[model samples]
Target: MSNVTSGDRRVRRHLTAEIKSSLRDLRNQLSMLNRQVGIQLDLKDIDMDCLDLISRHGPLSPSTLARRAGLHPATVTGILDRLERAGWIARERDPADRRAVTVRALPDRGKEVYRLFSGMNSAMDSICADYDEEQLKLLADFLRKSTDAGLTATRDLSASGA
Candidate 1:
């Protein structure tokens, strides 16, 4: 039989609760940060999400971006127009398919967005400095696993019609 005692179980529960609370609160804090960034840049929430997607995995087709962002193709067209007008992104012909177009974030314009996120990035760097290489690796692994779990849960929920 297992040798686990009640006191150990209580401590484990407390630790798990604290970690869960931190995770939930962190999501809200990140959302707030994004909102502030959006406000300063005069962009919408969906625009920020789409922008990040393009910046990270870009030179993507507008249709691909719309699918990823869960926005309608017509709506994406308006957003692309706005972003182009604001000098945030550019639309270029897809070399592989001359009839199609892809969107790309402007590197020079990206610097402004990074500038706004610098505070959080610096703080994260400072936090990482407190951990040794092994510990940091463990944390990174845990985070990656957690993200995979979240994606699985999201897919399951969608399948369940939730």
Candidate 2:
């Protein structure tokens, strides 16, 4: 029905496979990078991720952190305990809600973590500079869609008890 030929389909399939492979490789590399950073910071993977989330989203309640991290509230409690013990974060009473508490990142600890990633951030910025505005916008869109798909797959797998 369409004008596409067998050769075109084959090419498309090959490109798709390559893209999948590249994405997997990237994910693995990022995991390894996180692991290395965690070790350097004397923190666990989840601990580092928690710090990142806090840094990005500002102060958050334990329940919100657990939801964002895809972790159980009790599990997040332990993680928060560890982070608090390590002096990376502090638990503060919410000013607007006296009954609630929120976690905030310690400035010095956050700065140290940011310093660890400064080189990588610089490199990524350099790479981005090579792309024009249109190309950068397209790349941003692709990344957003890919991230959403990944989150959906994670939810589906978790629901299936996989």
Candidate 3:
């Protein structure tokens, strides 16, 4: 019959529901935070996703950025075009590979953006500051693993669909 143990089944069902709820809440929080950041930066139409990608692995080619951002190459190109026009980023030819291009953030602008992001993050950090350093490290490790697993699942699902 069923392979599931009663305790395991209950745990799985609870965890699945919890994960969905957590994702929804996190998404909403991010949306609100992005709106705030946009207003403060005078970038009313900023795309948070693009900012996130550049913040993480900038100075990367559009193709490499696409892969890292989990977006299509053309989409990355469009985002880069806008960012470049906004004077927030620049694209330069790779020194060794003339055919390839790399995207880099304007350091001064990047610092400003980082300040905005860090302001929001500081509030979050303060909330968790009661925890000891080791405890915080463990929490970070847990979050990292969860993020990796979620990315893996998304990749697998897309591959299966293809």
Candidate 4:
């Protein structure tokens, strides 16, 4: 019974440690990728948090985007103005709420942005090529979990006024 308990403890400890280490590794890797992606996509001067929120959540209200990006509404409007002028994005009245405007990514410009970063992205693809489909899926799963955890932690920290 004692031996079984000892073995169980070891297993639990190993699993926890592995998870912690993996999360750290993923965070570091993503930080590097974020830097590269910004440069490659010509988003270096663009506020990435805004771009990320817009990309993931689809077209957003200027106010919503500002809140999510942690920027003032005026700042978001200014950024949107620049993006619109650059032909990379557009703003149109929201169908459900004609008073509200939604900003959206133009597909052509989006493709161009992706094309610009294709080289670095290709390198990332090559790195993933060594992994089998199952391993790739597992890695993706971990990535999602890590992102969720980070978001949750951020929320909690903010709520606590940290």
| Backbone clashes, each candidate | 0, 0, 0, 0
Cα lDDT tens digits, model 4, 1-162, are 655787799999999899899878977986786777667665644555566567678688889898776677989888888777777677899888899898877777667656756777899899999999999999899879977888788778877987
RMSD of each: 1.8, 1.2, 3.7, 3.5
> Candidate 4: lDDT over CA atoms?
0.77
The whole-model lDDT of each prediction reads: 0.92, 0.92, 0.80, 0.77
Superposing every Cα of model 1 onto the true structure, what RMSD results? 1.8
Cα error, residue 62 of model 3, in Å, equals 0.7
How well does each candidate superpose onto the true structure, as a TM-score? 0.89, 0.94, 0.78, 0.71
How high is the lDDT of residue 53 in model 2?
94
Model 3 segments more than 4 A misplaced: 1-20, 39-46
Per-residue lDDT of model 1, residues 1-162, tens digit only: 289999999999999999889999999999999999999999988888889999999989999998777677999999999899988999999777899999999999899899999999999999999999999999999899988898788768766977
Tens digits of per-residue lDDT, candidate 2, 1-162, equal: 499999999999999999999999999998998898899899999999988998789699999999989999999999999999999999999888899999999999888888888888999999999999999999999999999999999999889998
How good is model 4 by TM-score? 0.71
Where does model 2 exceed 4 Å of error?
none
Residue 85 miss distance in model 3 (angstroms): 0.6
Model 2 quality (TM-score): 0.94
Query: Which 10-residue window in model 4 sums to the lowest lDDT?
Result: 40-49
Output the lDDT of residue 23, model 4.
72
In candidate 4, the residue pairs with backbone N, CA or C atoms under 3 Å apart (3 or more residues apart, or in different chains) clash, namely none
Highest TM-score against the true fold, candidate:
2
